[model samples]
Target chain A: MNHLLNIVRKELKELMTIGSFVSVLIMMFVFMGAGSMMGDQGESITSPSDIGFINGDGGLWADRTEEFLISIYVDTYGISEEEARGFVKVMDIPLDDGAAIVEGMRSLGLDAAIAVGPGYSSNLDNGIRAVISEYYIFTNPGLLGSAGSSITSLMIGEISDRISQALVSEIADPDLTPFLLSPIKGTDAHTYIDGELHSGVRPLDISMGVMNQTLMVPVVIMMVIMMIGSIVISSMGNEKENKTLETLLTMPVGRTVIVTGKILSAAIMGLVYGIMYMVGMMFYSKGMTDIGGLGGSSPADLGLALGPVDWLIVGTMVFLAIFCALGLCMILGAFAKNYKAAQTMTVPISVLAIIPMLLNMFASWGSLPTAIQIPLFIIPFTHPMMVMQNLMFGNTAVVLAGMAYLALFAMLTIFITVKVYKSDILLTGIGQTKLAKAFAGKRIR
Target chain B: MDALTVEDVHKVYGDREAVKGIDFSVRTGEIFGLIGPNGAGKTSTLRMMSTLLRITSGRITVCGHDVATESDEVRKIISYLPEDAGAYKDLTGRAYLKFMAGFFADGAEAEKMVAYGMEMADLGDRIDSKVDTYSKGMMRRLLIARAIMPAPKVAIMDEVTSGLDVINAFEIRKIIRKISEQGVTVIISSHNMFEVDMLCDRVAMINDGRTVLCGTPGELKERFNASNLEEVFVKAVKG
Candidate 1:
C-alpha cells in the first residue's frame, strides 16, 4: 500500500512542479479575475424603465408602501444614491381612480406605473383580498426590462407579506405576528420553451445554467482537456523518454498497480485544475451577469432546484466521461516518443471532447435540426451534459441512453489502455504486430 | 560454488535471437564483466540476468533461485542499473534515494538505507537540490548510488560509466571496485575494455549473440598474445 501511495505521490509532485501546471492555474484565475472585475459594473443596475406611482387610496398601508419605495430607489436599482435620484417620479394628477391614474401615467410616457385603490386598506381590515392595479410598457426587453421586473416583483411580494402578517396577527395574536410569516399560495414561474415544453420542469435557470454554459462551460471543458491530457501524456512520455519505464517494470510491483497509481495521480491533478478553473469561471460568470450578459434577473428569479437523483445522474455521467478521456489519453500516450508527441496525440481527442460542449452552449438539442442533433447524440462527450440538462426536466430516455454510452465508452478505453501497456511495443515504440516482426529483436526505445 | 549462473540462456524476440545460448557463472563476490561491441548482446545478457526480460530457454539463477520462476525473490536480492538511466528530474537526489529505499524496506530501515545510499553518492549538500539542476557526472553518481543502495546479493550494472569524462569515469570505477571489495557480486557490461580489464575478476567476449571467448583479462590477453584487453577484443572480433 505504501509503495502504491509513494508512486502516486511522486507522479503528482512531479506534475505540479512542472511549469505548465502553474501556468494553467494562473490563466484560470486571471480570466476569472477579469470577469469578476467587470461583474462589479453590471451589479450596479441603471433602470431603463422608470417607475411611476399614483397614490389614490391615501390609506396608511398604501402610503407606507410608497414611502418605502421612495426610500429604497438606490437599493432597488443597485445604483449610487446620486444616480438613483432621477429614477422614479410621483405623478400628481387630479384623477384618483386607478384607471385614470394608469392613463395619466401612459400620457406622461412613464414606462411602468402603479395605482392604489380606495378599498385596499378596508379590504385588509375586513380580511378580504386587496388588489393594486398596475400598467407598464417594457421598452428595453432584453436586460433592463427583465431586471426591473424581477426587482419590482420582489419588492411587491415583500410588501404583501407584511400586510398579510398584519392581518393574520389581527385574526390571531399581535404578539406572535412579527415572529410569524403569513401563509400564502402561489404558482411557480418558469422559463417558456418555444415548443416541446415539459409541464412541470422549470425553465432552465438563466444565470446559473444558461450563463454557465456560454461563459463557464467552454473555458472549463478546454481546461479539463489540456490539464488532464498534458498530465497523463507527459507522465508516460517522460518515463519512456528517460528510459525509466523499463527500470520501473523490472521492479517487483505489478504492471496494473503502476498503471493505476499513475492514473490516480493524473486524476488528482485534473480535479485540481478543474476546481481552480471552476472557481475562476464562477467569478467570471458573475461578472458577465453583472455586466448585463446572461444576468439581469433578481436572485429569486434565478433560483434553481435540481433534485438529488438528478445530481446523482449528472455526477456519475461526468465521472465516467472524464475517466474515459483519461484512459484514451493513456493509450495514445503510449505510442508517443516524447512529451511533445504525447501532447500532440491527444489533440484530436481534445477536439472531439471540446466541440460538442461548446456547441451545446449556443443551441439546445431540440432546437437544432435533426441532422445536427443525431451527431450530438452519438458523441460520448455529449452525454454528460445531456444527462445533466434532461434529468432535471424529466427526460428519462435521454438520460438512460447517455448513461449506457458513457459506460461502454469508458470500458472500451480502459481495455485499450490495458492492452497497450501490456504489449512489448510500449517499451520499444514499434508500430508493428508480432506477426509482422519475423526478425524482431529490435527495442522500441 | 557459483553465486550466479546462466546455463545456455537464450532470448528470442520473434524470429530474431538476441542472446543465443550464452553460458557463464560467477562465484560469490566475484566481479564478472561482459565485453562486446554494439549489438553483441552484452546489455541483453545483463538484462536477462537482472530479470528485466524473459529468457526464451535454459536457466538463470542467482544464489540458487531461478530468475524465471522466482522473479520476485530474484528482484529482491538484485539491483539492475541500465546504461544512461535517468532519474526523475523533479526529485532531489536525497528524496530519490529514499523513494527507492521505500520499495524494499520500511520505516527505520528505509531511512537507514537512504542515509547509507546518500553517503555512498558523496553528493553532500547538493543532494538536496533537484536532479535537473545536477551536472551529467552528478547524475551518474546518483544512479550508481541507487543501484547498490539495496545492498543486493547481485548488482547488474550495464555500461555504468558509458558517457562520463575521464575524471567522472575514474570516480565511478573507483566506487565499483570499492563495492566489489565489500562482497557484492557484480556483473558489468561495458565497451571500455581498459576499465573492464582493470575492474573485472573475469571477462567474456560476445559476438553475434554468442560468447566467442571467456576467461580473466590476463588469461584472455595471453591467449590472444595481446598487450592489452582492447587488442584482445579486436583480435576476438577478427578471428
Candidate 2:
C-alpha cells in the first residue's frame, strides 16, 4: 500500500510541475470571466430622432414615437447604462415626414431608423394603411433579429394604448356606472390568447439551448480524450523511463497489481481534472451566454430530464472510459522505447477515442452502425454522453446497459494492459505490429 | 554454507549467447570479484544471479531459494546494484532512505537496519538534500545506502565505482570489506583488474561469457607468471 501511495504522490508531483497544466487552468478562468461580463449587456431601445431625423413633418410623430419607444424599451429589454451609450448612436438617425438617412445609418450598423412617408398624417386621417419604414441594423445578424422583434413589441403596445384610448372616448359617460344601469352583463366576455405569448420567448433563447448543448459535446470530447490519453501514456512512459518497471515486474506483486495501481492513480487524476474541467466548462458555457455569442436557454433545460441514477451511470462510464484510455496507453507505453516516443504513439489513439465521441455527438444513437456500436459500447467514454443525452430524454434502460458495458470494458482494459506489460516491458524501442500481431507477439529478427 | 550458488547458468539474447553456462559459488564472509571486458556478458551473468534477469537454461540459487521459481524470495535475500544504478531524483536523500526502509517495515528490525545502512553510507550532511543536488559520488553512496539499508544476506555491486574518485572508491571498498567480514556475501563486478585484485577474496575472469580463469589474486598471479592480475587477464583472454 505504501509503495502504491508513493507512486501516486510521485505521479501527481510530476504533473503539477509541468507548465501546461497551470496554463490551461489560467486560460479557462480568463475566458470565462470575459464571457460572463459581456453576456449581461441586455437589450437596447432606439427612436428615429436618436438617428438624427429632420423633415417637413417637424418630428411631431417621430418625437411621440421616440418617447413611447423609450418607455417600452425601459420596461422590457432592461439595457444597462454602458449598453445604452453604445446603442444611443443609432437613435441619432432622423425620421420626420417619411424621410430618414437609412442608407448611411444602415452602413454603420445602426439599430433604428424611422421613415415617415409624405402622406403619413394624411393616410391616418383617410384611414388608409401606409408603410412607415423603420429599420434596425446590427453587426451581428442575431442581434439585428432581437432589435427587430423588440421594435415590433413596442409597436403592439402603442397600438393597444391607442385602441384603449379611442374606446374610452367613444363612451363619454363614465364606464363604471353603465355596468349597474344595464343590469345585463357586457355582451359575452371573450378570452383571447395572443400569439406573442408563444412567440415572445426569444429565438435567442431556443438557439441558445441548441448552442449550449452542442458546445458541451466537443469540449467534453476533447477533455475526455486528453484525460484518458495524456494521463495513461505519460504515466506508463514514466515507469519505463525510470526503469522501476523492471523492479516492479520482479516483485512478488502480480503484473495486474502494477497495472491497476497505475490505472487507479490515473483514474483518480482523470476524475479530479474531469470534475475540474466539467466545472470549468459550466463556467465556459455560462460565459458564452454572458458574452452574447450564445443567447438561448440555460444548461439545466437540456440536462434536467436526467435523473440521479442516470447521472451516476454517466459518471461511472466516464470513469471507465478513462480507465480504458489508461489501459490503451499502457499497452502503447510498453511498446514505446521511451517517454517521447510513447507520447507520439498515443496521439492517434487519443484521436481515435475523440472521433467516436464526436460521431456520437452529431449522429443519433440508433443511427450509428452496429460495428461502431459494439466497439462504442465497449468504450467507457462512448456511452456517458450518449447515455446522458438519452437520460435527458427519459431512457433509463439505455443508461443501465451503458453502465454495465462500461464496467465490463474497464475490466477488459485492465486485463489487456496487464498482459501487454508482462510481455513487452523489457523490450526496447517502438515497433509496429501488423494487424495479426496486435493481439499477440512474434519474435523480432 | 554458500550465500549464493550459480550452477551452469546460461543467458541467450536471440542468436547471441550472453552468459554461456558459467558456474561459481560465493561462501558467506567472502567478497567475490567478477572481471571481464565490454560485451563479455559480465553484467548479464550478474543480473541472472541477482534475479533481475532469467537464466536461459541453468539453475541459480540465492540463500537456498531457486532464482527462477522463487525470485522474490531470492530478491529478499540479496541487494543488487546494477551497472547503471539510479536514485530517484526528486526525493531528498533522507526521504529516499526512509521510503526504501518502509518496504521492509513488517520485519520488526527495519529501524536498526536503516540506521546501520545510513551510517555505513557515510553521506554526512548531503543525505538530507535532494538527490538531483548530489554529486555523482554522493548519488552512488545513497544508492549503496538504500541497497544495504535492508541488510540483505548477500550484496551484488556491478561496476558501482565507475564514476567515483580514488579516495571514494577506496572508501566504498572498505565498506564492502567490512560487510563481507560480518558474514554477508558480496559479489563485486568491475573491468578494473587492479581494483578486483585489491578487494576480492576470490576472483573470476570471464572471456566471451565463459570463465577463463578462476582463483584468488595470488594464485592467478603465481600461475600466469605475471606481476599483477591485469597481466593475468590479458594473458587469459589472449589464450
DockQ of each: 0.27, 0.09
> Distance (Å) between predicted and true CA of A77, model 1?
44
Error of 1 at A23 (Å): 25
Expressed as tens digits, the lDDT of each residue in B1-239 for candidate 2 is: 87888888888765567788788888887899999888787888887776666678888888899988887687667787776556667888887777677666645576776677678777888778887898877877877777777777888888978979998888888788887777788998999988999999998888888888888999999999999998999988887
Residue-wise C-alpha lDDT for candidate 1, range B15-47, written one tens digit per residue? 578889788889888899988888888887887
lDDT accuracy of residue A365 in candidate 1: 47
Maximum-lDDT candidate: 1
| lDDT, candidate 1, A1-445, per-residue tens | 6999999877776554323444455556544643553353244334434667666667776776575555566655576655554656677754334345545656777645555657666655554556554444432122222344455455556656756655665677555453334322222222323222122222223323443433354456556866787778877888888877767766666667777777767767766787788798888877776775345333233333456876687668767767777887888788777775576566556655665665554444444447656767777777775554454345678789889988898788777777776565576554344643432223222
Q: Lowest summed lDDT over 10 consecutive residues: which window, candidate 2 chain A? A: A188-197
lDDT of model 1 at residue B210? 86
TM-scores, each model vs. reference: 0.65, 0.65
**What clash count goes with each model?**
3, 19
